[model samples]
Target: MNIPKNHLWLWLPFVVVVCAGYFIIPSNTFVQELVAFGIMSLSISILSVFFKDWRIYSLVKVLGYVFLAFFAFVKLSFYNQYGVPISSSALYVIFETNSGEASDYLSNYFNGTTYLLLILLLWPIFFLLKGLFRKNKFQEKPLKRAFLYKLFLLLAALGCVFAIHKKFKTENIPYATLTTWDDYLTAKKQLKDALAIPTSKAFTKIESKDIPQTYVVVIGESTSRWHMQLYGYGRETNPKLTEIKEELVVMDSVITPHVHTITALEKILTLSNQENKAPSPNGSIIQLANMAGFTTYWLSNQKPVGLYESIPTIIGSAATHKRFMATDDYNYDIYDGALLPVLAEILKDKSASKKVIFVHLIGTHLRYEKRYPKMFEKFQTPSKDLKFQHEKAIIQTNRYDNAMLYNDYVIRALIEQLRRQDGYSYLAYFSDHGDEVYDTMDFLGHNEYHGTRPMFEVPLLFWFSEKYINEKGSIPKDIGNRKYSLIDFPHTFASLSTITFKGFDASKNVLDSTFVQRKRIIKDSLDYDKR
Candidate 1:
């Protein structure tokens, strides 16, 4: 068939749409959708030549453009913030969240990707609308083979829709919002059930032999030791920590049991050893602390999500008292300094003869720029060690280091506050997991799929008050070099608190004289040494 030469360029708009979706979404399913849409555009252009009903053709063209633009906007909005395709985890974290969290995330983290998406959308719309107005004569019908070939294209276009559904069973094509709500409800139900399931007793006997004292267990989030000068990084990211080095015992070879937040914390805050590393409903550090007659207090800078309580919050609920200092809502992360005032209040409370204080910090989770205040941006010069993979890589690295710097200040202040207080005081600190920030790789976050050594390597430190040091003697030198995982924290905590429990394993405690070095396993089955 002889078609108008000018009309042949109608495919340009489809090509633009495909290219735009590729860059903006940058996922396999998204590419599949673009391919399917491209085929539809091609078929429509070809069909316009054979069919004389202009109204029907024009309506189809308008609807296609509208769908394309709407789909692109959704993908672009989510991709800019998450840097990944829409998934169940993201859906639960977003929709199950409050307006404050959503607001914080949009205000702080939305970057250059927003503008790039806009350009991609506008370019395609320009050519597609222009092509719609051109007058066309009835082109001569082509060979039967040509019509069959065009018809095959239409089927293939529809097949792309099937291919997408096959890959992502829950995700809806053209309208991805359907999956967001569906996955959210499904996940919420699963989480609810998981929390409801009961477990058998983990401990048979429990006892505490120590005098009245306040023991502080501080848990940090997404902090990599590689970014801290205390761990020998080039930057002055740990000035406060360096100043108080004599009182602190830095465990140099410590790594977390998992690379993700909830997974690592689950193991860290439970009596789950290597044989039973999964978090048990029957046992947790708080329960053990509570059993030993120590009044437990859970104070945190990490904001609690609306109604959707996190695993940490559930675990923290075992404490006699609980407080969350952060007010940033869901996606918007806040500074850890908000916890300082609350920590002061907890320290002043003398009603409990023996107390266990658990301090959880927001601690450099993500959106690094917002994790610290302006005064903490000490690393002004671009880091020479960092290699860029993303456009904001350098800036992100700088912000991360600054966050670490601020974290150092917060921790040091806590230590000083504990020191000033009367009686025996023991403070131990470790992050839930480390993060990847252009360390060995060009990435700047932690994920289960792309696990790295830096992602599990975290900072572990213990501080003793002058009075406690004088009474109990200095912390053992062996504790500094001990290679251990946070999974053994329950055993170590029991030992430090002078608690004798049935599940307590002396060999697992790094401070214990009988401490044994076991295989450091991460992500449940993989050995850290092998990984």
Candidate 2:
């Protein structure tokens, strides 16, 4: 099994190229690069042995280098522009872009750094070509241990297959691209089917009082009640909301049925609940409001694309008018306050006698520091009661608290803007789900597999305008303490708006007199309260 030194050294160029490319890409990890190197080396070695002709093997090897080098360049350029890897959303946008738009993007993004990265990525070609040109004797005759060598190669191929399967299960670039493409196609088909379903079939009857009224639904993201002063946290993360807590119905026991954004929002905004896990045949709240003769508006600060078309975006499209502030994924520069002006403009519209507005905020999502402005960085240090004492955990806690503080300002501003309006309006604010930022565990993000209390306990607050309270009576004495899950959000929303249709369950409405306490299930399996 002795091999020539020249033959062994030939594969070194491929390994070096792959490792360099991975190191340059921000999204790739050290372990991923190492595994990728192993797979590449083993594959080339096996192929070289199988292909008896040296010229054909060299051609195959060069083709592999070309493929890897092309993707590496594209990924590096994308990272330079977006500070993130190329995602499905990015690919979707690219494919949808016209020639003019593509030109503009190239002109804007392709700069000195991009060219430098291309140059750095191209250096491996020289080494590869030099090694290919150097004359090395190929083993044309059968060796003594040919059977053993073939068996070893077979085992190596199986190991590579196992590694590839494991890597595909992760969030690596190759897996992301393939899965995103599949999801994009599926979502496109679902969106088409949903659009074809008539609004009339979704409801038997839609009845509401013919009066000038407005309802605002604010959907927040990754905000936990445990971190807010309004919920009795020691930090002043909710100073603005705390000042007017008396006027707001702060629902004390509300939780989301899921932790992820798309799953939780699909249930929250539609009639789909734990009992009915399938897509709701009855349309979303926006469609319901539209059927009820209210001019609906959907304004969002969150990106519309989550890998593919997010469920929230699909549902939001049912509104009479929809505007998403962020065009691309991971563009966190846009703040929630930007949505306020749009809300104000929508509130001022006089053409519609009745109005239902949905505002989605990117409140306190991961990379917490990017969620808020520098001025809102109020919490510089972590609290004394933090369970994890590491510097990174402490920083994350502070950043999250600061983001919460900014969110407080945004929510209070929304209430005040609605208060100045002339109609009977009530605004409901709730997060799609909460985050685990050094709370109950050392985790900083939400994971359904590793469920925790803070990841499901979201803040649900309601602000009733003075005129609305006078018209609809005072807030219920026991409404805030009612055990609630956001799966019944549309039912409660209908109750608040005095709207009724077929299949509307009064017991599911937290504010209704027939409201009943049901088991709050999370992740489709565990009881949230019992857990």
Q: Which candidate should be chosen as best, given lDDT against the real structure? A: 2
Model 1 weakest lDDT span, ten residues long: 191-200
Segments of candidate 1 deviating more than 4 angstroms: 1-200, 271-280, 329-333, 384-394, 466-473
Tens-place lDDT digits, model 2, residues 1-531: 655443444365445445554645454454554456457566656655554555565566565665555655665566555445565655544443334335435643467877876776577666556645554455344235477778888888877767766763332345556777787677656654563232535676789989999999999988989998988888889989899988988888999998777778878987767777655354688888888888888898877654235566777877888788876443345578888888888888899989998999989876677778899987887688788988978888998899999999999999999999956999999999898888787666775645678888999989998888898888876678899999898888998998999888889888778999999988766788887
All candidates' TM-scores?
0.71, 0.73
Alpha-carbon lDDT of model 2: 0.74
lDDT values for all models: 0.71, 0.74
